[model samples]
Structures are given as C-alpha cells and as structure tokens.
Target: MRMALRALPLAFALAPLTAALTPIDALAQPNPAKMTFFITSAGLGNGADLGGLAGADQHCAMLAKAAGAGEHIWHAYLSTSATDGKPAVNARDRIGTGPWYNATGVMIAQSVAHLHDSTANTGKQTSLDEKGGMVNGRGDTPNTHDILTGSTPDGRAYPPGTDTTCNNWTSSGDGSARVGHHDRQGGGEFPTSWNAAHPSRGCSQDNLKASGGAALFYCFGIN
Candidate 1:
C-alpha cells in the first residue's frame, strides 16, 4: 500500500508537464493540408454560360465540398462585362483577401496584388485542382491550357461596349470569352500571362475544346 501510494504522487506530478506539452505540440505542428486554391477539374458543361456569377459560385462550392473543403467559401475567378447600364464586376474583387494555398499546401499568393504581379507562381503545375490533379496544359495531349477567365490582364472586367466575356458568362452561343494559359506559355497575345493568355474561338464547349481548353476556370477560397 505504501509503495502504491508513493507511485501515485509521481504520476500526478508528471501529469502537468504532459498536459503542457500537448498544446505545445499542437502549436508546433503545421496547418492541415487544406485546399484553398484550385483550377476547376471540369466546368458546368454549358460552355461559358455558367448561369451567371451565382451559378458559377455554386459550382465552385459544390466541387470544393466534394473534395472535402466544404467549410471554406469558394468563388469562381471570373469577370462580368458591363451592359444595360450595370457596372462591370472585376474578378479580383469577388475572391477574398489572398494567402491562398493549393491541396499540397503550396502558397499561391499572399494577396490580390501579389497574385496579379508578373512573377506570381500560379502556373500549370502549381495551380492544381482540389483533388491535387494537374490540369492539362500546353504541349500536353489535346492542350487544355486555355482556362476561361473573362477578365482583362489586370483582373478587371473589360470596358463597356465590348463582348469579350461571353455575354457576361450567360451565353453558350456565338460569343467569345477571354481565356488564360495556365501553363504560362501559348501563341496568343498574352502568352506568358497565366490568367490573360487570349480569347477563345467561341463560347460553346466544342469551341472551347477546339481552342485548347476544357472550359475550366480557377476557384479560390474567400475565407
């Protein structure tokens, strides 16, 4: 009984140290490999007509949820052209303040400004989807590098009286939409611009495919 009683005190005394280390260990550990940025593995299948910003946002949320990232707010990185007296919406404004990371925990950007900089790291290999799969880029079979952005080089909506946004992302018809080269290499005007490579042939899915795209876009966590 005496030996048992003595051993109890030692166990009790060491308990506080163990308890203290628990929190320290947690603090020392890295953040969970949660996906905060990704390219859409697939689009809504209706060409550029993503049913407008709401529908596109919903699509992003749905895909993220399926990839186990439902807790974060997801937004499609697209711009809307001005028409009918409505002001244009910039793609940069929709997504939240940055510091976004991919599924592999690679930091893509620290802020919107950082993302727009010429030296940004959002390339084909880094801009993976929520499932951590690499979207096909230039030089790959079929060449799906043309990611739809609909925004200008500065990540803002095009000027009024223009139709570079596929009728504000509400048309699957004869309109054209701006596309980016996720691979950061192409023959278009902005070949080196990851999100502003050039424009697509048309807004149809078949057209997008013909122009080396799969109708995909980038999705970012806003929270």
Candidate 2:
C-alpha cells in the first residue's frame, strides 16, 4: 500500500520558464496532527508501484479530506529517469488537473506556477542541431527546489541554508532531493513547521530513482 513515485519528464524540462516567486502569507495555517494522518494514508495507499501523476492526485485528495481544511491543495510528484538517476522532467505538469493552493490555504498566485520537480533541472537545448548539442537528460538535471523555506509553521525561522526537500526525505538520498519540509538539518519538528507554513501546499512526492526506488509522503490538515 505504499505510494509510488511517477516519472514526469515534461514538468522538469519546463520548470524554469514556469517558476515564479510569490509572497509568503502569515495566515491559513496547517494542522500538524492531521497532516501526519494524511501522509500515512498516502504512504499506505500507493507507496510501491510508482503510479505516476494520477497517484499523486489521489493522495492529495485523501490528505485534504483528512485535514478538513479546504478543497484546494497543491500536489507535486517526484520521479527519476531510467537513464539518468535524477528526477524526471516536467513533474509539475499535473498542476493543471487540480486545485493549487499555497501554505496558508490561500489560492496560489497565478504568477506563481508550480514546478513538477523543483529539485530537477530543466532540459535546455543549447545547440542549433538538436542532435549535436548535449541533450539535457537524466543525472545532468539539477535537484528540485526545497519544499519549505527556512521558517516553520509557527513562524520560527531555521538557520540560513536549510536543506528543505521535505527534510531530506527524497526517494533518492544522494543529497539531492528531499521529501517534506526541505530543511534537512532541522529536527523532526520540520513536518509540523511545514504544515503550519503551507497548509494548501501539503502532500509532496519524492521519487528515489536510485536504489530500487523509494517514495516519501507529507500531508497537512484534512478537508
């Protein structure tokens, strides 16, 4: 019943063009205890097959119901390519299929589009000859962006340079992608902090493309 990581090549390649910075809101907090339940449920439901984007959405809906917060939520899937051991491309393409919200349960700004695999790099073609240039593929992509900023749900900021990546719980532990809060050095409190900071952005997917594959779950508040 474990959650499976899905491959999202399109999301990764278009991330940079879609990534946008937005202001952090101080309200619409997340309930940590509820979030825990959401994560556990998602892990139990599809943590094994790597069902792809559909699995990620199903888990997000489950978390929203468990939290009883709102109908809107942002879900992201993480996966790696068979050729490159890094996160797959365009993981964020699924955003169009569901409701997207920020940490405070606030609808995310239109300008702030979601990136499928923030940790992974967008594959860009630099050469005129599509075949001649180094085609960005596999391990060549950079890591996804950290899920949480340095601050916690309660507004306590972490030391500068926190790991974020859902507290370094990436499917692959190569020090690249993390699963939940993004801040690695921080203590377990990160799960709670992340929930508090972003109730809507709850539920994250980490695909450990390496080591036979792995998946980690995070959730905030029930619907």
RMSD of each: 8.3, 23.0
Candidate 2 structure quality by residue, lDDT tens digits, 95-117: 34323333323332122132122
lDDT tens per residue, model 1, 22-124: 9866643323246788888899999988988888889999988888888998899999987888888999999999899887777889999999998778898
Best by TM-score: 1
Q: lDDT for model 2, please.
A: 0.30
The lDDT for every candidate, in the order shown, is 0.86, 0.30
Off by over 4 Å in 1: 1-33
Candidate 1 has a TM-score of: 0.84
Clashing pairs in 1: none
- The reply for model 2, stretches above 4 Å from the true place, is 1-42, 45-50, 69-75, 79-89, 97-100, 106-181, 184-214, 217-223
Which 10-residue span in candidate 2 carries the lowest summed lDDT?
122-131
